[model samples]
Target: METDAPGEPGPTAERDATIEIDVLVVPDCPNRQLAEERLRQALDETGLRAARLTTRTVTDGTTAARTGFTGSPTILINGRDPFAEPGAVPSLTCRMYRTQDGLDGAPAAARIREALRAAAAAGGGA
Candidate 1:
């Protein structure tokens, strides 16, 4: 991890200290690509290149429940469901997120990116 400047925690200090993120998706949904793209953009914007971003497909409700898998395109930051709210269930069904516009199966790119940055700043790691 490289530092963007002196005196600041090297990129490694923050990005390496924590901030592992992943996209939990179902194979049936094609929106996973969008999620990945959004994640990549977030990483770039937040300087989390070594964050080890990846993806996992939720194949069963049991795994979903364990992982708090709400549906395809579930973005997990440090193994925690950032998208999971109070009433969300671990279902194999598709997940939806509330955006400024309306409800959608995936979260907005900017929203996800900001969350990623915050998680990184907080040293949130898996």
Candidate 2:
């Protein structure tokens, strides 16, 4: 029987420390590219260089439901939806974000950065 040494984390603990970020989008979503770029900038700004960022394509309602994808360009941090609002529905349409500048196809850079920071703090991995 092998046990983790004192003051050393086990494999599962170390794996749980990783932050998983997913940008879910549809094939025809125009804002997908911008979302990806913004997410990258946010990751860099938040100093989460080791975080894993993945772009997943959600083609059908079933996939969306399974992926917890609210809509195209939806971002999931650590397997949780940060921008989820009450009454929001999961679909394959392009998602709209309410920014300081009004409605937009994607969330602002500051918002993405804030989400990353919040997720990191909650995960205690920052």
Candidate 3:
């Protein structure tokens, strides 16, 4: 990884890497928009403009299970749920994120930014 200030361009190697981010939410989930906004912010802050983002609406339990839908507003980076805890079961309920301030409906920008960086370091967030 190359060293560059926030909002600046990173190394060509990172730019060439492919990153896929998915925001999965159930119908009537209140935090969906907020989560998407925070995710976009994280991507921008981490200088990952090349990332592809997808928003999915999981409406059924079976679909949730097959898609790894842990909860509404769940974020998956490269098909891996970075925020998922071990032994977490798939559900259609609204998810709570552990933010720096406290537990909230969505993950904090800082947390998402860190996750993005960690994924990049791991070679294209795979």
| Per-residue accuracy of model 3 over 13-117 as CA lDDT, tens digit each | 454256789899999799999999999898878878678899989999998998788888999988888888788899999889887788898889988888888
TM-score to true structure, per model: 0.82, 0.81, 0.85
Which ten residues in a row are the worst by lDDT in model 3? 9-18
RMSD of each: 3.3, 6.4, 3.4
Best by lDDT: 3
Worst 10 residues of 2 by lDDT: 9-18
Query: What is the alpha-carbon lDDT of model 3 when measured against the actual structure?
Result: 0.84
Residue 40, model 2: lDDT of 83
Q: How many collisions between residues are there in candidate 1? A: 1
TM-score of 3: 0.85
Query: What lDDT is obtained when candidate 1 is compared to the true structure?
Result: 0.76
Show the colliding residue pairs in model 2: none
